[model samples]
Structures are given as C-alpha cells and as structure tokens.
Target: MKVYLAAVATGLLLIAESANAISVNVQAGRHFTHTSAAIGDNSAGLSFNGNWARSDHNGQLGSLGTAFSLPVGPLTASIGGKALYLSPKDGKNGEALAAGVGLSWTVMPSLALYGEVYGAPPRLTSGIDSYAEAAGGLRFTVFKPLTVDAGYRVMNMRGKEGNRDNKLADGFYIGAGLNF
Candidate 1:
C-alpha cells in the first residue's frame, strides 16, 4: 500500500510539473464521529492543479481535468474530472477517479460561496468497492496570489473484502484549504 501511494503521488507530481498553468493546494479537515476515527479523525491532502485554460463562457479553466467556468448572470458554474490516489488509514489504499461539477457565486470581490460533488464507482480503485464525496464552503481572497477557504465535506468509501461490505470511511468533516 505504501508503495502504491508513493507511485501515485509521484505520477500526479510529474503531470502537474509539466502542466501549462499550475497551482498547489493544501487542505485539512476533521471527521465526525460516524467516521472511522475513534476519538477524532483529522484529514489533510495536497493537490496540484494544472493545465488551466482561460475562463470564458463555456470555457475550460480551473483545477482538475477539462475544468471550465462560465458566468451565469452573477454566478459562475464550473465542472471538471479528477483522478486521485487514496491512502486511507483504515482501509485498502489505492487509486480512484472522480467526476466533479460545482457552482460558485461571488458575494463580493474577495468572497465567494461554492458547492461541489464528486463520485467514483466500484472497481475505480484497486481493493476498493466505491467512493463518493461532497463539499460546500466559502472562499476569501486575502492577497493577490493567496486565497483561504473553509468548508464542510462528507465522504463515504466501501472496501472490497470478498463478500463482505467493509465501510471504510463515512461521515462529515470540516476542513480548510490554501490555494495559490
């Protein structure tokens, strides 16, 4: 599992390094009691976003694959697909892919509200049955090249254990991220 995770992370890093426009994101969150954590579970991840096009009506721009954003009146609608690596502490760790779509509304020049959902089916990741996640939050621009975001995320994963349905991770989480 460690080898698998290292390989996946290396692949993602290589892809991001060669991408046209790239950004690095770091996020941290806490899981609820319903999750696998006995006392409290804390989750964190680093992601590299790359190959972004210009943002226009029906255009492709932002993080993930083929990301695009459009200004619908005063709101922005965006969607993208992402392939990710999973290294859960309580389950079989592997790789998975997710297709995500989101909507964002800018309340002010530096503040925006957004919500997104991502889903992956069985067999998408090795040794995993299925996974799904959803998040909603607010983002605030603190400086020109820096942004801060806080959100609530819910994630569920089922592991492949022969005929047994192993619930790996499931519950709500509160997280924060830095985008640059």
Candidate 2:
C-alpha cells in the first residue's frame, strides 16, 4: 500500500509540471475461476491514460515513467501502472498496484484487436503478494464517442506465506466505454 501511494504521489508530481491530456476508460468483466470461491471473481474498474509532463532521454513522454505511450509501426503500444481495489463476493478483499502493457492493432477503421498483460508483486498487494493477468479482446467503435468491447482474461494470485498460487479468474466479458 505504501508503494502504491508512493508511485501515485510520484506520478502526480510529474504530472504537475506538464501539459498532458487524460483519456478515461472503464471496464467490467466476469471470472470463471473457483480457486478462491470465497471471492467470486467478477471485476470492474476505470483507468486514466495520459502523457506525463516530462519526456524521457528518448524524447518519448513517460517512456521511463509509470506511464508511457509509444507507436510502433501500425501498432500502438502502451505501458503503465494501475492500482486496483477488488471486492469479492465472500468479502475476502484484495488490492494491488499492477503494471500493465498492451498493444492494439487497428485492422479496420472502426475495429481493433488488442492484448494486455498485467502483474502485481507481493510488495504491491495485501495478504496475497503476487498477482498476474493476461487478456485479449476485440474493440468496435459503435459511435463517435462510444466503443463496445468483449474479451477474455486469465488471472492468478499467490499468498506470501504459501508455496502455491491460486487461480483467481478466467472468463469472457462484454463491455462498453466512452472515450474522449
């Protein structure tokens, strides 16, 4: 928790000096794993994507920071850290500051294919120390400001005192979002 706060504090400090734009995205999904039946794995969250106030040695904004935006040929590649607060059905809650990286390919004007990988270390989590996830999905621009998406994700978490990790969730989800 301290690490997450420190990271956010550092990011906010960096943002104070730059002229950047923020893009918001919200998502919700269902899970299939029963390893932790006490916590039904449904999840939802929102994120802010933006360029930081400073540029790296490579002249890329947030290139070496907690957030980054870089274009690789026809694909847009981005990486950032996200703090997540998850509420389970059984109430055995979990929180983690996870770092994620993703790539998107616009195969068509209104359609794109994307994939992302996210992981949270023990230092960033409470109770459970290690968490990891991977997802792939299709995104369709439904209107000028709205997009509809569907995807599948797999995630697992391990306790600090335990030798084995628990499979948390694996399922498909449908969602909609507005991008500005």
Candidate 3:
C-alpha cells in the first residue's frame, strides 16, 4: 500500500509540471478507497491518468492509462486503454489491458454527469479470465477549482480457476476533486 501511494504521488508531481490542466480525486466508501489523477484539457490534449484502489475483498488494484478527448457541444467524449494490475487477497495476482470509453456532460455551470466503462476479455488478461468495470457519477462544482461527487461503481474480475472470482468494489462512494 505504501508503495502504491508513493507511485501515485510521484506521478502527480510529474503531471503537475507540464500539464495544461490537472485534476486529482479521492474517494471512499464502506470498505474501499480510491485515488486518481489526470492531466490534460477537455478540448484536445493527450490525457495521462493513474489510479489506485484498495478494497477489503480485492486487496489492491492499480492502473495507468492515456486518453484522447474530443468535445461535442456541451459534452466531452474520450477513448482510451488502461493497463491494470490486480492483487487479490485470496487469489492469484493478474494483469489486464482494457479498452474503454467515457462521456461527460455539463448540465449547468456548477453541475455535471459522467460515466465510463472498461473491459478486458480473457485473451487480453493474464492470471485472470476477464475484467470489467463501470462507474457513473454526478459532480457538483463548489467553486472554480473544487468539486464534490457521489457515485456508484462496480468492478469485477474472474480468475482462471474456480472459486477465485472477486467483486473488487461495488456500491456507492463519495469523493472530492481538485482541478488546476
């Protein structure tokens, strides 16, 4: 856990140097905590992101990815791929490469909605049969650079062997974000 935290912290520091825009988010739930950072702008820039999550059921999961964003009217759409490393408390560790899409819409100056889905088939995974994740949330901007959000997320992984399937995270989470 300490190692993962350090890696994310280092990534954040690196991102702060050259990114035109940057954001960091932290989330917590009953038995789960997640942290992520991204650097880029919505109009058209290469976005780099990294995330770490720890859960009672899954132990830990971490990912790194890059995305390209395109703006259409009041919405922004992104396409990306992520490389995921998963360590389960009672199962074998695994790696997966997932392809994903995300969409965000600004409803008002202060409110927005966002959703994303990522998945990896058995062929794109190792030590695990498959991986999938979906999340959506409503975000409220408290001010220009601060926001709060609430959301539901579900992440699942199926191990190669039976009895190793794990629901890494499921249910609601509340989070806050800083954008600069």
Candidate 4:
C-alpha cells in the first residue's frame, strides 16, 4: 500500500506541481462508542476501541486531501477529495477514499462551514477485518488556519470481502484539523 501511495503521490506531484491547495495530516483519537455500532452481545468489542493494542482499537489515522476553490460571481465554492488510513495496534488497517464537494458562503473572512462525505471502494489488509466509512461531516474554520469538524460514517462489507472477514463497521466521529 505504501508503494502504491508513494507512486500515485509522486505522479500527482510530477504532473501537478501547481497544486498548492492541499493539506495532509495524521490524527489519533478515542473514536466514540457510537462509531462502532455495538450490536447486542458485542459490547465487549467496542470496549477495546481506545485500546490501540487491541484489534478494535482506533490508533493513528492518516488523512490526505486536496481542495480547489472556484469563484462564481458573488459566491465561492471549494471541491476536494481525501483518503483516510488507520493502522490499529492489533495490526489491522483500513484505507478509505472520499470524493467530496462543498460550498462556502464566506460569511466572514475567516469563517466558513462546509459539508463533505468520504467513501471507500473495498479492500483487505492484515488479518483483522475492516471496511470503509461512507461518512459525512461538517467542517468549520476558525482563525483561518485551524478547523473543527464532526461527522458520521458507516460502511458494510461481506465476509472475506473486507479485511476483518465479515464483520461490519458503522459509527459517528468527531475530529479537528489545522492548516498551514
């Protein structure tokens, strides 16, 4: 996967040296319980969410995204896509791809709210099963360089079709971002 990402990123950089509107980051957090979609008799599975050492733990998640802004008379809109990858302590990692589009009213010079969604095609990694989160969230920027965001994401996969065999993942997420 690293090789694939490196190749694609390298290609993008080579062909698109003008892509200055981009942000790449890494995030780790205690994904709230709701993000796990705990069904009956499966509460124990979610208990280990924050336990990075456990298979279900949500450890360091990396995200890469690019945005392009277009001006239309009085309104300005930005459309972009992002990829999120999370490597669990239990040795399972899932990669998701999101093609998102949003509009900003630019009510203030430093503040704007945008809605976006992320989705994954399908993949397998390691022995632990995992799938993508077809999720949506809102992002609000403050001070122009920092942003706070919250959203819900869900993905369903058939056994062996995902990394964790046949288990499903569905849940809500809250996160933030910083831009340079």
TM-score list, all predictions: 0.58, 0.58, 0.86, 0.41
For 1-180, candidate 1 gives per-residue lDDT tens digits of 999999999999887655433333343443232111011101112222432211111111122344556676658776666665554444565666777777788898888888878778876666467766676888788875476776765555555675333332233333333332
Candidate 2 residue-wise lDDT, 23-141, digit = tens: 33444545342111111101112224421111111111111124455666667777767655533232245677788888888888799899989788878886566767787899899
Q: Give the local distance difference test score of model 3.
A: 0.87
lDDT order, best first, reads 3, 2, 1, 4
Q: Which stretches of candidate 4 lie over 4 Å from their true place?
A: 1-56, 73-76, 88-97, 123-180
Clash numbers, per candidate: 0, 2, 0, 6
| lDDT of each residue in 1-180, candidate 3, tens digit only | 999999999999887776678899998887888899987774465788999988876678899999999888889898999999988776788899999999999899899999999999999988788989899999999997999999999888877777477777898999999988
| lDDT, candidate 1, at 135 | 69
Model 1 scores worst on lDDT over the 10 consecutive residues at 35-44
Against the true structure, whose lDDT is highest? 3
- RMSD (Cα, Å) for all candidates, in order, is 14.2, 14.1, 8.1, 13.3
Q: Who is ahead in lDDT, 3 or 4?
A: 3
Which candidate number would show the highest TM-score if scored against the true structure?
3
How high a TM-score does candidate 4 get? Answer: 0.41
Give the whole-model CA lDDT for all candidates, comma-separated: 0.53, 0.56, 0.87, 0.42
- Candidate scoring better on TM-score of 1 and 4: 1
Q: What is the lDDT of candidate 1?
A: 0.53
In model 3, what are the clashing residue pairs, if there are any? Answer: none
